[model samples]
Target: MDHDIDVFAKNYIYQKSILLTKTAQRADWDREDVVSELTLHLLRRRDQFNPGRGSWTTFVKAVVNNRTTDLHHQLSRQRATLSLSDPRVSRVAERLEDIERLRHHGVSIDPESDQCDRTIDLNNVLSQIPQRDRRLCDQLSRFRTADAAKHLNQCRSNIYRRIVSLRKEFSSAGLTDYWK
Candidate 1:
């Protein structure tokens, strides 16, 4: 039997070994060292790898999961050194308290409000355009810019220009004048 492995096998083994090692060592140890060791181990056992047994992907996934579990247990033992008195935890709590206080003061923060207003303004502005421009704008807004360009068969720059034009129209129509 020829001892030389195919390029696909070599690449598959190398990538899987690295992922396995990283998943294993990320919790407590340096991921690089683990990857190096795993690389060497895979290279050494390359001859033993059989295509009939299972896929290289499955084998690598299993190895990664096993290594990750081992590292988790190892790190869990070491984590006892850390105490709850860490200042970062207190800072996070303080920030949460501030948010709660704002809520209590009848001041609500809605993250989607800006997006909703933009969407409403865009719809209103689109209605004023001819049917073709209105349809194009609606399609463009469905995707931000890049996605809209691809979907609408327009260049990214063209999509941006259209959006700008729509915005100007909305402004002129007093749709956003209420914000002033």
Candidate 2:
């Protein structure tokens, strides 16, 4: 009769160090949010708790573990979805670093390599984008968002929207994983 949900929620967050888990951190969840979700899930599954199979604590703990993982996965997906449409900081240095690493490794830069193949595919996808948007895309490639906005005689917000649309295009082309 002592199935106190509040106690388990607090202990899970603190003594169990659920919040300290790397996945939880990456999910960017606050204590209240996690607890709220945990409570909701536990309440909904109360009827499924089998006292005959195991004790209340055991059932609750298993539920907590599973729900924690599920919440992290859901939140991570939401974060990725949001960022995919957001104009992020330019990653020009990262592209340069890839070239530097290949040179440092003394690897022959072949056009048929996986990276080159991805690049070719990406170019093909870029060409498929509307002709009217090519100038904006070109400006974005060579400059920062603000600078690109200036070059195009448009506001920064306008540039941000264009970048978001470009990301959507890239996403539809199945080139998202390639860039990552």
Candidate 3:
């Protein structure tokens, strides 16, 4: 029993060492460090392995993927921190603010709209409404009264009534002139 356990441990380590090396290569990591860390983690979890349920390689792969993901996140945070204090970054930020101020004054240097592309044509006008009324506007915009009455078995009068209410809300919010 002792010899069998020893062989199993050795085989598990040997197979997973190769696998960790490959994973580290794909992630552009130092293979030696990744393999060393994976070996330590496997040793820590040795008692948890159940050969009947799954292969040792599967467990080691999961650990490697998780560790590499964590490392990537740590490196990303470090890069972000470094960039924040960089003088060039501050200069770029100041330039962006200048461009934004010019754009807001309607200088029209750039053709693209500053707002994100709208899904519905009525979004600009409907956005001024309270959240509860926004859903009604979305439904009205999505389904024409005639189509909704035919497919959804809804009444055209209900759709028209909602549209009239939304138009009143729009006019009260001074959004009607925004479209003009």
| Best of the candidates, lDDT | 2
Query: Higher-lDDT candidate among 2 and 3?
Result: 2
lDDT at position 9, candidate 2: 59
- Alpha-carbon shift of residue 131 in model 3 (angstroms): 71
lDDT of 2 by residue, 54-142 (tens): 98778877877788778767766664422332334234444445555666777555655777556545666766888757887787668
The order of the candidates by TM-score, greatest first, is 2, 1, 3
Give the clashing residue pairs of candidate 3, or none: none
User: 86, model 2: CA deviation in Å?
Assistant: 12
Candidate 3: residue 54 Cα off by (Å): 1.1
Give the candidate number with the greatest TM-score: 2
For each candidate, the alpha-carbon lDDT, in order, equals: 0.57, 0.66, 0.54
Best-to-worst ranking by lDDT: 2, 1, 3
| TM-score for each of the candidates | 0.28, 0.38, 0.28
Candidate 1 lDDT tens digits, 1-180: 223444654565456546654544433355566555555554565555567887665555454445545545665555433235666677666545655555677656453575444444454566568786676666754656687678778788876777677667777966654323
Q: Residue 37 in candidate 1 has what lDDT?
A: 53
